[model samples]
Target: MSIQRVVAVVQDGAEPFGLGAICEVWAEPYHPDDDNPVFDFTVCTEHPGVVTGRAGFDLVVEHGLEAMADADLVCISPKHDFDHHAPAVVEAVREAHERGAWIFAHCSSSFLLGQAGLLDGRRCTTHWRYAEQLQRAFPKALVDPDVLYVEDDRIVTGAGSAAGIDAALHLLRRHFGAKVAATAARRIVVPPHRDGGQAQFVRAPVREHEAETLAPLLAWISGHLDESLTVERLARRAHMSPRTFARRFRDETGTTPLQWITNQRVALAEELLENSDLGVEQIAQRAGFGNGATLRHHFTRVRGIAPLAYRRRFTCIESA
Candidate 1:
């Protein structure tokens, strides 16, 4: 096998937490006696000197952007500031991509790539707080705020903090197969592959109600997503008029009843598609999408892939 050379570009005010996460997976000798290092990683920066990290630790870099010329992969860890991206840093990323190097950026480093114009016309994600800024700064790049990461062509970006691990594992899987990725994850004590689209920790809109509002009914609705559900039917179950139930449902759940049901149904469909032998029709029924066509439409809309294709690419039944 050919050696894999990777360069991690660091800068001032860089989040060492993200840098450490990248090193733990890619830089360290994960498989000590397996013959060779999985990656030949070099910590690089614009200036070849002692670079201070956000946490006050000194990171001494020996290589500059010139390192990217010979690198198979170029990685960038997140920095704290979103507004003041260095032009030199952006040019290095652009040059690396132009030379056909696989570009990986965790968290806010994606903003750097966006600044460099490499992420234009590509779907990308970053820390949710910076989502608006990323979109405003690079209108050509499609900014997805909810996903853990997005892989558009050779450019891969992971969302904030721990989500970087997910993106790194995905890169591992793409290069070395699920087995190698799993081995690396076991060494690091993390899941080998997390479906990258898992939501960033979002507070559930529904709150507990004092009276019999819609909690039990909502739970029941989740269980029977394939069942024909309507506002009037749900209201009857809650023993309230349709109009009163609609208003109360909004108050209790913090979302309209239909929207809440659709979200749950989609989540259920995703689980079935990932874990079970069920066909599209069966998954749709179980997840309350009505039919295979409906499931396909919503699945493609939300996940950007067909159900079978997603299963083929991501299902780890053998590994699990």
Candidate 2:
């Protein structure tokens, strides 16, 4: 089923990145490129306004838990004190689930689901560090520590940090399709797919040296997405061996040269589609896809819709 309304429920001491991942996935920008809908996204808390973040910053939320009443999807974002139960938040999720909203949890947020009695007899997962505790707390929960995420009975739970992105994309794929999901992934510069069962591994943080060294090259590449961006050519441009450049590229951007270029091109094509009157072939040329067919091929593969269809979505001029 297609979901258009999304409500993320947050509590005090929310984990910043965990909440950010939920917003990143559900707070979508309209790209009819895939016949995608603009989501009506809201972030609600039990007590609205000045919600404290685990990272020391505070969020000024405007809505309360009642905002979840009509949501098509409800996400429980992780908090620093996830094990601590808030009765209002728990009951809110319980009601949402009973009313047939798609329920999701990120990291220790799964514990909230357990408190709501939603995880009972449901296969779910959480961060590896908390898996055992979660299983013990909710004995009826079939918690799988080995998986990145788990979805059962309209409920989804993901491991800590960035794994939330994987679980969100999985939900997007379920509502839309692989192409639409892939397009969203590209927009965020994440790998298009990661299986739910993939082992959670340590991700190295980018060192300052890597970003500093590659800053100029990355800027240049962004500007030249319309040009041939082969790794060897880029390596030469960076004055490094192809092998060293490839490794450095990954280290800096978390993606390879080719993938980065392709993502940039797709982004450019999307922009042109939204704001330009250029024909498909012209848009393709400008975006470095070379021609309409190539643009269509990639657009269809990534966005699940053709260029013309994408353009038509934005063609109607709205009166102010």
Clashes of each: 2, 0
Q: lDDT by residue for model 1 over 204-238, one digit each (tens)?
A: 45456635556678778877788888999988988
RMSD (Å) per prediction: 6.8, 8.3
Q: Evaluate model 1: give its lDDT.
A: 0.78
In angstroms, give how far residue 164 of model 1 lies from its true place: 0.2
Cα deviation at 143, candidate 2, in Å, is 0.6
Global lDDT for candidate 2? Answer: 0.82
The digit string of per-residue lDDT tens for model 2 on 89-163 reads 899999998988999999999999999999888999999999999999999999999777888878999998989
Any runs in candidate 2 off by more than 4 Å, and if so which?
31-36, 202-320
* Candidate 1 clashes between residue pairs 3 or more apart in a chain or in different chains: 225-288, 226-288
- What lDDT score belongs to each candidate, Candidate 1 first? 0.78, 0.82
Model 1 compared with the native: what TM-score?
0.65
* CA error at residue 153 for candidate 1, angstroms: 0.8
